[model samples]
Target chain A: MTLLAQYALTGVVTGCFLILATIGFSLTRQVEGFLNIAHAEMLGVSAFITWGLNAVAGWPFLPSAAVAVVATAFLGLAIGRVVYDPMRRLGPAVLLITSVGVAYVMAGVMHAIIGTGIRSLDMPLATSYKAFGLRITDYQMVVVALAAATGISLALFLNRTKTGLAIRAMSSNPELAASRGIDVRQTSRATWLIASGLAGLAGVMLALIATLSTDIAFNQILQILAVAILAGLGSLYSVIAAGLIVGIAMDMSVYWIPAGYRPLIAFLVVILALLVRPQGLSGKARS
Target chain B: MNLVQLFLAVVMFGSLFSVLTLSLNLQYARGGMINFGTVAYFAAGAYAYAIVTQEPPSGLDQYLVGLHGPWWAGFLAAGVASMAFAVLTGWPTLRLRGEYLALTTFAFAEMLHSLLVNERRIGNGTVGLANVERPDPGSLGLPDAWAYAGAAFLLMLATALVFRRLLASPYGRAIDAVRDDETAAEAIGKDIARLRFEVFVISAVPIGFAGALYAMITTLVSPDLFTAEVTFFVWIALVLGGERTILGAVLGTMALVGFQELVRAFPFESVRAAEIAAAGEDIVTGILFILILRWQPFEAMVKRRAAA
Candidate 1:
């Protein structure tokens, strides 16, 4: 029972960051209808940026995270403008390929800049709270709370805001939405910024949780994809649920499998989800 | 090694990749299947070959499958193992279309990678299988490089001949029909799913052979040897050389690998030079991929026009 409780705690903590990583991908899928392979780099960008600021430059954590988030938001905006916007005329395949190319560039640029080594966020140690055989750190609690807050606010934004409504309308039917006077360009750019900013925040949180490395993006990318697909790629609420399930599943897999096989759980879930529920938990069936 | 040996090594590596590229070309260019999980079969073949040829580990070195066999038998085992893997995984995954199918394949490849890296009993927990036997050509009075290059070239030629015959056959036409228009092909009674499954499985054979050859040439096999980057490398080569053309695979591998070697040969005397060399190829390839996406080749244009 104690072991299960510990696993559950760790699973929830891991799930918080998984939610953060996948929400952006889900949002983009809803609006853009293509997998942004480059979005995987947004995490690395923010993590490295915050690492540079807090660890290298001796700046405090909040300011570094804020700047990193803004930087990543702009990075997404630039990719949308420079690469995606122009090539979208070609087709989704071209756009998908371009996103992959963008990912390669991001990986190359990260390699060129940092030169490959694990770098941790330079923060003081946090006190832990233990209850019911689970030990939780202050940082881990903060991560979960932040994710909850982000998820709630995102729900509010999508359900209550006029811009969010326009975004959804555009996603569902671009022609009809455009006819109804929704500015496609503005909405897309905003979606990019919001999603990218969320991805950046996830990266910052992840760097705090673990050591930052160039491989972080590559390592997390598959899991992020799995989460995105499991959530049906467009359902924000289901993304949170799917993230938690995958995280818990990964943690619980250690009981039956070796610790190294933890990553395989996500892939298995992905394949199963693709075969059984390609539309995801709450996603509408494809026409 | 001298420049000659270095170039010969490049040639051998190029030939190995040529086989891989041909497989990809056959699948994507001719068969219309976007397989992003090429590493799965390739790694399977390598591990199978290693298992067949390698001696059982005695002390600290332990791994799955250690049965000594002839090199030819190893190659055959590799091909068969790869085909079996394809059959197992492709049944459910082949039902998906376009990006979903590609993503599933990518997932499968990553799963295999994770398994290989994690399961110590499988590939020794990322330490990898080592000391794979390399056939010596000295008995035949041939330089090792020349002999290896000849073998690799011969394998590539055989692959191409088989590929060409398949393309010329009715099966190839059916695959093209599915690629061009799946619904139309189905309407015309082309059994799209079965065709895709067949191509997906058949293409794995050469890739399997390529993987076995790679293990033999390098004399080692590691999880790192079969990353998704290998898929991207082949994809870039195929796109750059023009898909569906006979010499596209060979030309594409030569160009990409040749440029990489040239960058490696740059006169620089620092660790940063090496980094630059590596990153330079990646950044250039990324840019080239973008450019290709913007303005695809004439062959693609023709295909699109015909489809329209």
Candidate 2:
């Protein structure tokens, strides 16, 4: 039972990381109507920036993270303006492949520049407290807390803010939103910034628990993609639930399957979800 | 490497990937099936060949099935095995539409890749199957590389001819109809699902052969060799050359492989220059993919078949 409790706690932390990654991915897909594989690359850039400032330059963590987050938000904006905006005229297939190209470019550049070494921040190890016969670390608690804050805040922002409503409107029907005098270009630009900014924060949080590597960032694309697909691609609220399910399943699968096959959990969930409910848990049935 | 060796490398990769690109053309360009799990089929073939042709595991390396067969047998098994895999995965997943199908396939590929890495019994735990048999071009008194390159080129030519023939047949027209409008094709009493499944299975055959040929050329098989990068490389080539025509597949492979070779051949001495060249290739390909789609430069390349 304690083992079960421990695995569940670990699963929540993993799910939190995924929620941060997939929410942005889901939002971008809602607007662009294609799978942007390059969204994962944003995490790589922000993680690298945080590593550079906190580890290399000896700056403190919070300030360095703030700068990295802001920098990556701009990077997202620039990538939106430069790559996605112009490419929007093309069909989704073209955009999908282009996003893949962008992903490869970012990874290749990182490989050439950083040489595939594992880099991590110099944060102190957190003390663990035993409760209910399961040990939980302070860092784990902090991760869950931060993730909850981000998710709730984002939910509020989308519900309350004009930009958020506009984003929601565009997501439902771009042509309809445009017909109603919603500024498609400006909404899209704002969507890109917000999505990429979320991606930046996710990257930092992931780096805190795991080491920073370009491959790690790239590999997470599959898991995030799985979460997005299982959540029906664009439904933000459903994505949070999907992320937790996937994360927990991935961690708990080790009890039955070998630990090395944890990825198989995500794969199975995605394939099964796609097969049974292509519309997803929250998606409306398309005619 | 000398210029001759470099030239041979280009020809080898070009022909090998030409086979892959053509397979993709049949699936996507002709049949309208978006299969993102291509590398899975490719790797399946390579592993099948490796299992059949390799010597028994020695020292630290332990893997399943070392049948130790002739080169032709291994190659045939590669194609058949990949076809079987496609049939298994395609039957259920083919019901999905557009992005859903693509993501499911992508998930399947990633799952297989992980399995290959973790299951040492199947793939030898990332060390991979090595010392697989290679046909001796030495029997003909020609260089080994020349033999490999010549074999790949012949395979490409044969596959391309077969694809061209298929495209010219009523079967080809049926698929084009399905791709253009599935409901209309169904209205005309064509079995859309079965046709798609057949195309999907048939397309896997060449890719499987390409994977075996890749193993034969490199004389090794590893999970790293069959990454998503290989799939995208084929995609970039097909999209760049134009999708509907056979000429596009060949030309795209040549153009893409040629561009990479050009960058490699240039004497960029600085440390950063090499990195820039590497990253620039992807950036250029990305931009080109976007531009070609946005502008539809070769829209007329797709021949209309009496409105199907």
Candidate 3:
């Protein structure tokens, strides 16, 4: 019983991490109106920058993470303006395929720079706290706290600011938003930075909890896609719910099944969600 | 990695992958479906062949079934298996459109991969099935590489001819009509769903045959070899050749495979050098993909030739 409870706790942490990773992807799909396949590679970029600074170059973790996130945000904006802007004349399908090329290029650069090996941030060991036979680590707690903080702040930003209103308007209908005097270029740029910066933040949380290899970020794309789909591809609030549902389902399944089948849980969730509720938990038609 | 060896390798792999690109071309360009899980069908075929032709389980074998059948029977089974998988996946997914279809197919493929890796009763899990039986090409007084290359070419040519014939018919026009405008096709009494399902199943057969040929060429079937990377490579090839033409599909696959072969041909002194070269190849291939898509040089060429 305690084991199940413990698994659930870990699942929530996993769920929180997924939320961070997927928000950026969902944001891109909403505003830019295309799935960015390179979004996962952005996580790799930020994680590696953090790793390079803290582990390889002997900087403290906080400063390294801040720099990595900021750099990743700006980099994503640049790629957007340069690679994706002109291609807007093309449809979403073409843009999706183009992002795969972007992913390949970004992954190659990271591979050339980082090489193949396990890496981690040069930080203190995780301090585990146990109560009532349940355990949580400092880093895991950080992930959960950051997820909540980001979720709240993002909600406030979206609801309370003029730019946030512009973003929302643009995502729902880009032409309508433009005709209403929203700056198309500025909103698009904001979307890229925020989305990419969120990915960067997720990368930091990833470095905190898990051992990193060059391929680790790439490995998460499927799981991230699963979460995104369950959130109805472009919906925001449901990402939290979908993330936890998948994360807990995956972790808790390990109690009854072989550990090797854990990844299968995400896939099963995706298939079922897509089949049963194509519009997903958001219950709103994106089209 | 001599020039002769490189040429043969490109022809062999280019054709095998061309089978996949050709099928994708049918699904995407004509049927208006984006089936991103092409590797799963290919894997289904390979595994079916491996299981059918391998001898019954012996010492240390964890897999549950092996038919000990002949190569021809196994080849037939490969095609049937691929069609079966396509039916299973396509029936549920044909209702979805665009990126949703793409992601569902991708999820299905990953699910199958996990099953193959974790289910020890299926091809001994990650260890995979080796020493898969095949008829010796030497019986025909030909070297193995040359015989296999010829076999791949024959398979590719057959696929192209069949698809070309299918598309040129009235039914093919119906399929095109559906893609060009779904509502108009429906208005004309064309069953959009049925045409899609049929094309989805029919195109899968050649890929299964290609998978069987691939297993014969490599003499092995492993979870490692059938990854999303295979799917991505086929998509890139389709893009390179431009869509909606059999000849373009072939040429594009040949060009992409030849490019990779050229990079691999160079000898290296250290592992680092080799790794860097591989990375460089990825970078260049990606750049080329982006550039080609941006300029659409192949599409432009096709249009110009048509006008002239």
The candidate scoring highest on lDDT is 3
- Candidate 2 DockQ vs. native: 0.51
lDDT string for model 3 (B1-308, tens) is 78889999999999999999999999999889998899999999999999999999999999999999999999999999999999999999898899999989999999999999999998999999999998899999999999999999999999999999999999999999999999999999999999999999999999999999999999999999999989989989999999889999999999999999999999999999888888888888888888878788988998999999
Write candidate 2's Cα lDDT for B212-292 as tens digits. Answer: 998888788988888877778888888888877887888889888977887788888886777667767766776676667
Q: Model 2 chain B — which ten-residue stretch has the worst lDDT?
A: B299-308
Model 1 TM-score, 2 decimals = 0.96
Model 1 docking tier (incorrect/acceptable/medium/high): medium
Most accurate candidate by TM-score = 3
Provide the overall lDDT of each model, using Cα atoms, as 2-decimal numbers.
0.85, 0.85, 0.92
Candidate 1 regions exceeding 4 Å error are B1-3, B297-308
Which residue pairs come into collision in candidate 1? none
| Predicted model with the maximum DockQ | 3
Classified by CAPRI criteria, candidate 2 counts as: medium
Candidate 2 ranges with C-alpha deviation above 4 Å: B261-296, B300-308
Q: What lDDT score is found at residue A186 in candidate 2? A: 93
For candidate 2, what is the lDDT?
0.85
